[model samples]
Target: MKVLLYAEAKRLLSRSGIGIALKHQMEALKRVNVDFTLAIDDDYDLAHINTVGPGARFVANSCRSKNIPIIWHVHTTAEDIRNSFLLSNIYSKYAKFALRKIYSKADFLVFPTRYTMNIVRKYGVKVEGEVVSNGVDTQFFKKNEEKARQFRRKYGLTGPIVLCVALPFKRKGIHDFVDVAKRLSQCHFVWIGSKGLASLLPRDVREILRNPPSNVLFPGFMPQEELVGAYSAADVFFFPSYEENEGIVVLEALSCECPVLVRDIPVYEDWLQDGVNCLKGKTNTDFEKAIEKLISDKNFANELGKMARKVALERDLTIIGEKLKRIYEEVLEKHGKKDE
Candidate 1:
């Protein structure tokens, strides 16, 4: 069956995780040989919508009118949107109300993690939900010695590198990242994200960027090819986000076999195990110690990296494609019966 794959604000989201997830969904469908089109006007048996904006609402309404099955991929939640940009908390309040109304219209919902599914259910969205990871392309993100070397040289980076890939938002724990960087002056702390949106950042977040520690560097957004090298060149991939539906960067880092350290948040409860595949920390102090441990003990770091790659293998694109194909068939079959 042909599917209409749609994402609103594609240009604005291209630098963010939601955009990366959407791209992964397209690639996964391709791997499974599913026929899909990005155009909203394209004729299709089913629609998989990736955003909750006005455009997404129009698409959902259109699919409803035509009796076409709709799969709403819930990538954003009010809880995760708060503390991000200027007035994000204010927007989140209204966003929750709008999301419930929009999501309730879905034939089914796809969530990046069970954590997100549970939270959305609490938001009064009773639509049937399936947990599908924002899978990574292990083949594309794997470590390359030449690329790693080039990345380091291009940036004039020296010493152990502590990398964090995220937008310049408060909720992403940028303040905490900077605090941790101050504690470890020996390591080079590189935050790879979009600086173009710095104007929209919260006042405190913008202030932090203005007077960051000498060891810290904001290299702005990097291309996907450069990101592969960033992960490979990093001594550790440190993510301290306050909330996430699913962290796609974590999977990318794991796929590259880079040792990862993340916040002890609910979204990671199922897949990430502290001192196992990766390390977890709840505070800046905890993160500082974890980074130090990973950097000092090379053998331990390598072991964690190896195990992390195994975890990435389970959520690889090929596997996610098979899951999506089954999901599509189930939705189509159910919709057909209802139509009859």
Candidate 2:
């Protein structure tokens, strides 16, 4: 069946997690040979929408009017939106209301993680939902020493590299990253993502980006090729996000077999085991200690990286694509039965 895969603000979200997830979705669909198109105006049997903007709402409504099944990919929730940008917290309550109303309208809901599904359900969203991870392209993100060296040389990054891939926001733990960087001055801290909406960012976040610690570097957004090299070059992939539907960068890091240290949060509960596949921390002090341990003990870090790659294998794009294909067919069959 032809599926309409739609994401609003395509260019704007190109560097965001939602955008990256959408890219993965496209790649997944391609692998499964699913007939899909991004053009919202294209005719299709089913629609999978990945944004909460007015355009997304219009598409959902149009699909409903046509009796076509709509799969709302819940990439953002009110809970995760707070502390994101300026006035984001003030807008979160309204976002919850909008999300509830729109989610209720969908024939199905798609959550990237069970944690996110539970949160949306708590928002009074009762629609049938499934947990489909925002999978990574393992082939592209695997470790490459030559590429790693090229990236390190290009950025003039020397010594042990601590990398974090995320937008500069408070909720993303940018402040905490800076604090940890200060504590671990021996390692080079590189944050590889964009600051696109700088005007909307909180003043304090802007100040931190303006005057970061000597050890920390903000090289802005990198192309996917460069991202693979960054992950390869990194001695540690440290993600301290306070919240996420599913941090695609974490999966990317795992696919590269990069040793990862993340915040002890609900989204990573079942998948990420502390001191097993990856390390988890709560505060800056916890992060500091974890990084020190990973950097000092090469053998332990290598073991963790191996386990982390295994985790990535389970959520590869091919697997996610096949799951999406099944979910689409199941929904279509049910819709057909209703029509019959």
Candidate 3:
């Protein structure tokens, strides 16, 4: 069956998590040989929309008029949108109201995590949906010793490196990341993200980025190839972000067999196992202790990394593609368009 996949604000969110997720999902659909197109053609059997905007609202209305089953992919909520960028907090309530109306119009919904599904429900979204992870590309993110060494040498990261891939926002725990870096002077801390939106960051956060500690390094954004190498070279993937629908970088690090230390959030409950697949930290001191434990105990760290890799393999692109294919077929069947 043919499917029409669309995302709003493609240029604006090119470097954001939602953009990355759309790319991965499209690639997965193509790999599975599913008939899909980016355009809004009249001959499509199903429509999947990934953002909320005027264009998206028009598409949703058109689908409703044509009796086409619409699948709404929920990537952001009001809570996660707050503190994300300039005026995001001020507009969050309106965004939430719009989301509630948009999601209620969908025949079916897709949530990247159970945490997000529950959040939407609490916000009075009555639409039904299932949790499906935005899986990672294990082959692209695999460990490579040569590339890892090259990245380390280029960045002068000789000691244990703690890597955090996040946008420059207070909600992403940028301040917390810097605080932890201050405490651990011996280890090298690298945060890979853009500073172009520094105006959106808090005044203190901007100051911290401008004059960070000697051990803290802000290499800015890197290409995918370089990012794969960075993941391979790092000893720990420390993500202190306060919110996420699902942290795709955590899966990327896991695919590279890197140990992870993330904030203790409910979203990770389904995948992350404390002291097994990865460690969870609640506070700055907790993060410090977790990082220290991983650094001092190489064997335990390796064990956790191995487990994390297994989890990543289960959520690889190939498997997720099959899942999407099944979901599309089921939707078609339910709508009495299976023969189409």
- Tens digits of per-residue lDDT, candidate 3, 49-151, equal 8988888889999999999999999997988988777788898878888889888988888999899999999879887688888999999989888889999
Give the Å shift of residue 153 in candidate 1: 0.3
- Any runs in candidate 2 off by more than 4 Å, and if so which? 337-340
> Given candidate 2, what's the lDDT at residue 164?
96
Q: What is candidate 1's CA lDDT for residue 99?
A: 88
In candidate 3, stretches whose alpha carbon ends up further than 4 angstroms from where it belongs are: none
lDDT of 2: 0.92
lDDT per residue (tens digit) for residues 107-161 in model 1: 9999999999998998899999799998999999998888999999999987999
What's every prediction's RMSD, in angstroms?
Answer: 1.6, 1.5, 1.4
Worst 10 residues of 3 by lDDT: 34-43
User: Candidate 2: which pairs clash?
Assistant: none
- How are the candidates ranked when ordered by TM-score, highest leading? 2, 1, 3
What TM-score against the true fold does each predicted structure earn? 0.98, 0.98, 0.96
Clashes of each: 0, 0, 0
